[model samples]
Target: MPARPHSPCVEAAPNGSFFHPDVKEAFMNAVTTEIPALAHDAGVPPAPPEAHRTADELRDIPLKRLVASPYNVRRVPPTGIKELALNIWKVGLLQNLIVHPMKVGARKAQTFGAAAGERRRLALIYLFEHDYIPADHPVRCRVVPVEDAVLLSATENEMREPMHPADACDAYRILVEAGRSIEEIADLYGVHPKTVQRRLKLARVSPKLVDLFRTGEVKLDQMQALALSDSHDEQEAAWFDAEPYNRDAHAIRRRFVRDEQSFVSNRVAKFVGVEAFEAAGGAVRRDLFSAAEDAWYRDHALMLRLATEQLEALGASVLAEGWAWVKAMPERDHATRSQFRPVLPRRTEPTDEVAKELAAIDQRLAEIAAQWEADDMDDEVAERLELEEGALSMRQDEIEGSLLVYHPDDMAQAGALLSLDANGEPVIERGLVAREPVAAATTESGENGDDDDDDSSDGRPARVAAPAVKPTKGPHSERLMLRLNAHRTAAVAAALAQQPHVAHAALVHRLLAGEYGHSTEASALDVTFRDHSHNLTKHAPELDDDLAFTMRREQRRVWGGVIPNDSDALLRWLIEQTDERLLLILAQYVAASVDSVRPDERPHAINALIPALGLNLADAWQPTKAGYFDHVSKDRIVDVVSAAVSPSDAMRVAKLKKGDAATEAERLIAGRGWLPEHFAKAEVVRMKLWDVPAKASDAEASADEAEADEPALAVSADDVRDDAAVAEGEGMPPRD
Candidate 1:
């Protein structure tokens, strides 16, 4: 730099007479130009030189003086113009619009043509149209060269990051907290008032959940669901309890509300009617984020009370209709109604006028059906046919219903069951009669031996007992008999376990029975079966909550997972299994099928079987105060304690309160190996001796002596009877 030219970019320091050497050199190199090198030496063509332009100046110009650029790429929607105008009106222009001076002309006298922020320009026009701003209002603008305007507009429109939803929510909330009305915030942000409201709702979510949303751990919809509840505890609980993989909006909402909330769409809620329920002081919780059906009635108890009251009122109306009795319940499906015998409605012949109307309706329905059957029919034609058919069918149904009317006499003896159908419509089950006991037949005789006599000569009918009819049972009632046979089968199973020979014999007998006997009577034992296969109507509630039940359910779940879903694959897998494994599997199946009467049902048979199987009930069954003693009578509790400990111990607890006694009884019976009557084994019967001839009497006596010298085998006549009854295809003997 022998003689460097003065440069504007490089300035001399106050203490120095010349600029810095590096700064001066950089400025000289930037200003100096060089010719291209030889092609052979350069190897490639040189890039074009960088362009230089003067910096644009920002200026405030009149709104009318700024005109939209014809070459602008961004198109602002018409609806957005109003929102944009509101935003501009509230906050003023956030960024200056890029514009260039327009050439002066007769028709075009505007000051500049807008490139960037065309939407802002349109928004200003909107404000002018809406009388919010004067026509010549001043708008901020960046004065750029004409060529740079389109590039600036495209760059401004394309290069920007969207605001994170959480950030936006927080921003909205901050604005709200700063004393801004929702409408004001909406106007400032160019959003709907509802949008602002929703953002505020989201902002009210628990801080922890909001943090999770900010970190992207929770989704937008999930956050919305959490925001449905104002309680921080509920929001946190719902978020934490939700399955990570299945944290859907619905699941999140369900977790937040739980069973405490009942949907308005639910049958019970519909039956009660939302208006009536709310009138009864039930609070209805609506999801601001969802549709109307998503609303829930928070007070379930109040809703139920209202529903019950309405149902009872309906029942009263039915009772007033000369019925013997009326029952109102929440549920009255076929399963419930089947418990009662329905009195058949007396049939009546239709009157001539009604018959003619029914015939005409039926003919019309047939014609409509024929018309509807046309393949080339238009949608309108098909819809018309359907409407006509529906009308005719309704008339037909009315006529048919009128023909089947109950007599007043029958109604007097029978009753009606009132309940709500699936759609919340009233379902009246009429002509339901109470189950009558089966009565015994009576015989009458007169002095002249006439059958029409009311009484005998002694003034009483002879009390002759009716001959007993043997139960002709051959799978008469599958479900009832299955339960009855299950008990007998359990007892037999316990016996057969001790005597493997008996098991083998029973297996062979079952196979033979299948081949020779009826298919339905193939086997008494349900060896291949599943647990909880049959739906039990009656059982202790604790059975469901029992630890053993839970363990069994988990075991079944594991086994079900390992088992092949395809039948063919399962068969193949079974064929591939070792004999020992197969036997173990079979044992599990057999054990699960031993649906010995539940403790609440006829448990005597299972009680008898337990000891025979050498089962230590103490190992499997522990009597808790709530599970056992609490449910039993005080006398039973004392008896249990007495049997387990001593009579004194029993007497000590007998004077205590029932609950205290139960607790004490439980402690006493803990390790005593004592069981309730339902669980205790029945007495084992001994084999009977038979009469022998005198010649063989001495030998028989010697043999009997030898048998007496050996240990006695415990057996039961009831067990033997059960085995016989099973083999004979007859119903089991009644339990004692």
Candidate 2:
């Protein structure tokens, strides 16, 4: 037989340690244990949730007759009682109190214990004490048995949930508008002052954002971030007036404080010092809501004025260097900047100590380089070495420049510029020579007469809108074209390397047009003579099969092995070679300069060069799964299959998945000599390089513009791609 459980004992009344359970006057029933009789194996069913209170009778009990139940579940310090009192006073109690008769000496007692709603009972007492309600104010009560009182109280307290954060904020806002101070509200709710402030902050946010918060469009944290701004107009502007990319919590905070003067981290503010700016009558506002509490500077014009005055003082000090002029420019105009040529100082002999320092730096740099000999290095080590090298190089440059001075003649002909750098340090640029028209560009020794190296500071005023991320490109990315173009460039160079005649014409045409003032004319050969072989290597990847690139590399390898290593020895060897062998090597170098990387379309001049060398790009390259099929869209792969194979084959490939389709297309296009559209289109050109018994005598002396712009064609090779890249941000600087 199972033993029966002991009956539960109830503790007497409750809180500041509110609601003491050990009060002597409170009533609680005595505990008793009873054994149950054995049953015939039929199990009893469970009772409904509200079964304990279903039989209780509703009664209009006077407020004075109700007492807090010792069996009430909540025992915390009395909280929200004042608000509860105010609500009951204004609207009357909406919920009935759960209570039981407290039998005294076997007689019905006038007072009943409130098993639930102890807080409500307290609130009624509060209103009566304050004269807001009568002592015998009628209160609704559900009278239950004394034995069932604790269960009903526990259920009511445990089942309720607190209000939402947004609602709480609005509640606080209501109290504030009703003439309650923040401290009063904090004391009223037993919360801290900052809690009230934060709640009120949300309440004060843009009403549109408030609507967003209510509708779940804006989150609580986002609303809190927005509340940092005080003005409704500014808040709306920060949210709505901002760029689409800039409409986020972090960006909204930045846009609200758009005034340049108040930013404590501004370069000008940092340069002048926040204390100094404030002393100079600049207003500073501290954003307490910000995590870091960063300040904003309010005086834009004042900061600029102070920066200019300080620059003038700095410039005046530099005038002692005997410069022809020293100008202090808060903002250097382009017209003023254009007047002078940039100059790097000439270094004189360094002192013994500086020489040792330079040697130490060189030794360290060599050590790092030696350590970096491995094909792959640790990322941490690489990053550390990069930082170390940068610092060491900067120090080395400073030490090397320490011995530099302007020549007295140069100083007489030049001026110095004084302005602030990005960090707001006053930087002085000395030895800026005025641009002068000269009879010759070279000295008697054939050395360069100019000394310009063209380096300048990123000079600008404070304040910029938050930066936005660049939108992503389509599937046919620039990277794909860059790789393809790199291969094309390599092919053109390799082909040109074999054709010295084409190289000769291009070089001669460029030199004649540049030197002799044929400015108005365009050339069929618009090629520059700068080496971009490194750029070609940099942009292309997976180039083990680029035939022209491989061939050019092999040719370089062969020459590199055959040529004399020493410059003087090489010169002598070059002089000894027959004109044929020498022209071949020289033409190889000239051909390497032929960069024809246009992104999608070929230049009109390059169009002329294509046929000149009998260059066949189709022979040089072919599409493979990895190279072409994988990168293109499914539709494009199908199109390729249709073009290279048959429409039926394309339809079959299209039925397969993307990856499988690409594989099938690669298989179908393998033996077909079909090329992509970019490669298949080319215009025929005609060129007449050398004159043959022209009617005019000057025609022998000079080539005409008509001959250069539109030349007669060489051997034709059709179906070659013209998909080279636009210049990679660098071409020869326009001679203009």
lDDT of each: 0.60, 0.63
lDDT of 1 by residue, 641-705 (tens): 88778999888778666766776787778877665443443433222121121245888788755
Candidate 2 CA-lDDT value: 0.63
1-736 per-residue lDDT for model 2 (tens digits):
8966643233323211112344312422221111001111212122233433433678898988887655555657677888788777666788999886653333543577787888889989989899998988989998775555655666577778877777888999999999999997876665778789889888888778888888887777667667867888877876776555545575565555543444444555556766767888987655555665677766778877887777778887688878888887654344565566744444467778888989999999889979889778989989999999999999976775566656687778788887654455666767687777656435312224322321112222111111122333434546655666666666667777888777776667556433332221223333444455655655554443355565665564346535555799989999998787777876777776665554443322444466667777676657777677777899988887887889988887776667667666777788677766545554422223222222365754355433333433322234222312322432332222
Task: Give all TM-scores, in the order shown.
Answer: 0.45, 0.36
What's the lDDT of the predicted structure labeled candidate 1? 0.60
Q: Which segments of candidate 2 are over 4 A away from where they belong?
A: 1-203, 206-229, 232-300, 313-326, 342-344, 352-398, 407-415, 422-426, 433-736
TM-score of 2: 0.36
